[model samples]
Target: MTILQTMVSVMLAAILTDNYVLSKFMGICPFLGVSKKLSSSLGMGAAVIFVMACAAAVTYPVYQLLVAFDLAYLQTVAFILIIALFVQLVEIVMRKLLPPLYKALGVYLPLITTNCAVLGVTLNNIDDGYSFGLSVWNAVCVGMGFTLSLIIFAGVRSKLENADIPETFKGIPATLIAASIVSLSFSAFSGMI
Candidate 1:
């Protein structure tokens, strides 16, 4: 297949068929933490998309070179540094370009710096033997998938604020139940790729 076809396939697969969070359960913290409101969820998701894409773009080439040199054991450390610097770059850009958005998403952005989902996408890209372009595309689509799930959850959570759910299944319980249904619904896409 052409590079374009490969990129598109990896991206579509990550977003629809095997989302990092819903399908693989890589980053559940922000999935549950910042999803209380749609606005914040969107912000968080966007930040993730940017970070993951850049990280994948950079790390795919770097890690593969390291592996070729028999330094594969350094993947974790190298990936950490790469993710941190990439997120820092994003933070700087956001702070300069959109101060209000930076302020609004201040805490969440830092939290995402260490998000497994970001690093997981990078690692997955390497693990799957995708080319650099394919890694970036997959990271982007996976980030979009995360955003989609978070936004929907946020909307549901907001409405459920006044719900009369049973006392035994209130708060996190309700959230988990809701997420389970979402996960199950997303499960249908497992075969699409």
Candidate 2:
């Protein structure tokens, strides 16, 4: 495949078949927590996209440096520190410029620092042996996948608000069921690449 084909395939795989949230299930905490409202979900998704992309950009070279120093085992620790720094930067910027979104995200904004999906993208880039550009692209695509899942799930959850249901299936139970169905739907894309 050519470079363009490779990039497109990577983007499609990340945003569809191998979604971190819906398929790999890497970052479910914020996926479920902030998805209750469309507005909050969008805010959270944007923050995640920012952090994941920035983390990937920083971590790729940092990982190379670690490998050079024969400290590869410290990649996880180094990646986490880098991700945390970016998340903190995002938090500070959002808090100052977008107070409403900042308030909307609440504790979940901080949770981005610990989001495995962000870390996973950085680590997976190294594992997949992608060049710097591909790694960043993969991170952005993964973040888009995360956002897509959140938006779809948020829509599903919103519809559940007025749906009449058995008492046993209300609240969290209903949300889980809906999420499972949404996840199942994504399975159809498994071999599309």
Candidate 3:
């Protein structure tokens, strides 16, 4: 497929069917933590997408090169370091050029390093043995998945915030129930892959 087509597929896959937080369950904390508010969750989701795309774009080639050197076993550590450094670079750039976004996303940006979704996508790319284009595509898609889930979760939580949910089904309990449903709802997309 053309690069454009690949990009589109990746974007759709990430944002729609195979969502990271809902389907893969890679990022539950921020998905739940920042999701109490729609705007914050959106902010966090956007940040994750950016970081995921960047991580995949850079890590794919590095992973390929590392494999070439017969050092495939180092992928875990290498990916972690690469993602951490990239998040740092993004923090620096955001602080200098976009102070507002930095203020909004600064706290969460550091947290991205430990987010399993980001690392999961990196490792997933290697496991799938995707080409440079496809690896990056999947990574972006996975991030989109994360973003989509966060957006939906935020919306759900916002509406639920006003309701008088049962004692057992309040707060995180309700949130978890909602996520479970979302996960089940999105599982229909697995056939597409």
Candidate 4:
């Protein structure tokens, strides 16, 4: 396929079929925690996108260097270190420029350092043998997919607040049910691409 076609395919696959949060279930902590508020959800989503893309960019070369020196066994360790540093940088920048958002995200910001989705995308890029450009594109697309799931679920949670429901399933249980339904819907797209 041409470059454009490849990019389109990757975007579609990541955003619709292979979503990190919805489909792969990689980052459910913040997906459930920060998603209670739309603003916080968006902030978290943006932060994930920025971190994932940057992590992919930085880790790809780091992994390459590891391979060059026959230290491929350290790929996971190296990737985690890079991800942690990037998350710290994002925290510093966000804290300075968007204090309110920074405050809203609070602990979730630091939690992103250990978010599996971010690490998963980076490792997948390496495991899948994507070239540098494709790796970056895949990472960005995965981030966008994560952002989409967060915003969509945040909207659902907003409406659910007012919806009458059985007392037993009112809070997290209700949210989990909604997320499961959403996941099922996402599964329908598996054969589309």
- What local lDDT score does residue 120 receive in model 2, on the 0 to 100 scale? 90
Rank by lDDT, descending? 2, 4, 1, 3
Model 4 stretches with alpha carbons more than 4 Å out: 93-108
Rank the models by TM-score, top first: 2, 4, 1, 3
Worst 10 residues of 2 by lDDT: 101-110
Expressed as tens digits, the lDDT of each residue in 1-193 for candidate 3 is: 8888767877777766667777667888888788887778877878888898889899988987998999989999999999989999999999999999899888889889889989998888878677887876787677667777788777877777788889877767887887888788788777674
Q: Count the backbone clashes (under 3 Å) in each candidate.
A: 0, 0, 4, 0
Per-candidate RMSD, Å: 1.9, 2.1, 2.1, 2.2
Give the Å shift of residue 131 in candidate 3. Answer: 1.6
Provide the global lDDT of candidate 1 against the true structure. Answer: 0.85
Model 1 compared with the native: what TM-score?
0.90
Residue 82, model 3, lDDT: 94
lDDT of 2 by residue, 56-133 (tens): 889988988998999999998898988787778878888899889778665566888878898899989999999999
Q: Candidate 4 on 1-193: residue-level lDDT in tens?
A: 9999989999999999988898888999889988888887887888788788888999988998999999999998888988888888878888899889778665566879878999999999999899999999999899899889999999989999999989999889999999998899899999877
* Clash tally for model 1: 0
Tell me each candidate's TM-score: 0.90, 0.91, 0.88, 0.91
How does model 3 fare in lDDT?
A: 0.82
